[model samples]
Target: MGRKAKYSYEFKLRCVKQVLNHHQTVEAVSELNGCHHTTLHDWIRFYEKYGKKALLPRKNKVYSLPFKIKVLEAIEEDSLSFSQACLKFNIPTKSVIMNWQKTYKKSGIKGLNNKSRGKPKSMQFKRAKKKSSKPLTREEELLLENESLRAELDLLKKLQALIQEEQSKKRKP
Candidate 1:
């Protein structure tokens, strides 16, 4: 087995940028970076082809529609198996193709964009919580009730003081 090649994000971006600037062929930059010529060519093609977006790290289980379309197109053209398509595109999952196929079958192209498969019960609970928090836990309820009683008592005490002050003034007069 061959040793794995590694390049930092900055180094790869620099190499790709240099290739796009046309200062040197991809072959030369790949040599300088100790990367495979084909790898550098693909990197340059990807960078030139996709711009800044291509440099972003991909999320698992998320493939762009264009990339999905390309995978499907390749599969259709070459009658490639899932594994073959995965190898061809360096796609992360065979399941991704399967998911796309499932989505396409159900709702066509619009289905390919990000979508929730179904409303989970937990999601419903979360929504409910947002709309109104669950009734406070027993301890919290008791605390709130105690606080409310204290506020009412404070108001009552102030009222009693005002009444006592009025009676005292009338007696003085």
Candidate 2:
């Protein structure tokens, strides 16, 4: 397995202090900490230059759909290509352009707007699954009753046919 990433804020400060204040060489601190000399040098530079922002973890920067649409509009207005847009906006990828173009072509403005774009959480489905569902309409109940009566009548006709067949056989014998 790869070695875990080491990120000790206090340790970074100590290393930076040793390099800056004690006249310790980056190579010496690197050797003592089991890190690369270049890595130690970079840390020292980062501490000296950016202070704390260089050490703090960066949050994921997400652009909303509307924001993305605006970006695309700006790219179109500037007549910039995908690569140019990526460079101009400092975006990490080209898929952003492709996706925005697709949405713009499909929906004009509304497609780019934020909306719940999938099957809604089914309140109707939940109601249907309840132990006591809403009562059927009178027409629906009447139709069901008619169907049951029809089935009972058909069963009675079959019993009558069987009885007639048995009687006819007895008469023949």
Candidate 3:
């Protein structure tokens, strides 16, 4: 699911109308609405270029590598500003294009490839048990038994220490 917008479409349209139709200045409208002037200006521009649809919340789009390259090329070839590039390409925000430019500069075309978000499938909290067809030797079995015994001893020691601490605290107060 897409994230909810900070400003509703109606709110943006009202702000934009205050600036465009009411002859109010962008800074004045934005200041009154408690949003940045630049943000209000972008809204005005988007409204002008794409109408009310531009004010609606947009779904997160996964741009293909080729499409990213194309957008980057257009930005470079046309010397378009981030805002202009976003408006031209119908991208949701200028920061998205800015990040693309930074990634392209830092890692080249390979960086433009879409990466999976969130934890990878390979990550696991609990390790999988090893499976082997061969039986364990006597020495290996003895080593495993010793390890388990040591772990149990450590856990018992901790529990004993915690109990003693509680008893001492109770005696103190």
Question: What are the Cα lDDT values of the candidates?
Answer: 0.73, 0.72, 0.91
TM-score of each: 0.37, 0.34, 0.70
| lDDT tens readout by residue for model 3, 37-120 | 989988988899999999998888899999899999999999999989988988879999999999999999989899989777
How do these models rank on TM-score, best leading? 3, 1, 2
User: For residues 42-159, could you state the per-residue lDDT of candidate 2 as single tens digits?
Assistant: 6665656667555443343457876787778888898887766764565534686787789889988777766654578767543443444878889988987999999999999999
Candidate that would win on lDDT: 3
Worst 10 residues of 1 by lDDT: 123-132
TM-score head-to-head 1 vs 2, winner: 1
Q: Which stretches of candidate 2 lie over 4 Å from their true place?
A: 1-62, 115-173
The candidate 2 region of ten consecutive residues with least summed lDDT is 52-61
Identify the superior model by TM-score, candidate 2 or candidate 3: 3
Q: What's the CA RMSD for each of the models?
A: 14.5, 16.4, 5.1
How many clashing residue pairs appear in each of the predictions shown? 0, 0, 0
**Model 3 CA RMSD to the hidden true structure, in angstroms:** 5.1
Model 1, residue 137: distance off in Å is: 43
lDDT of 1 by residue, 2-51 (tens): 32435555777888888877688877888887888766665665565566
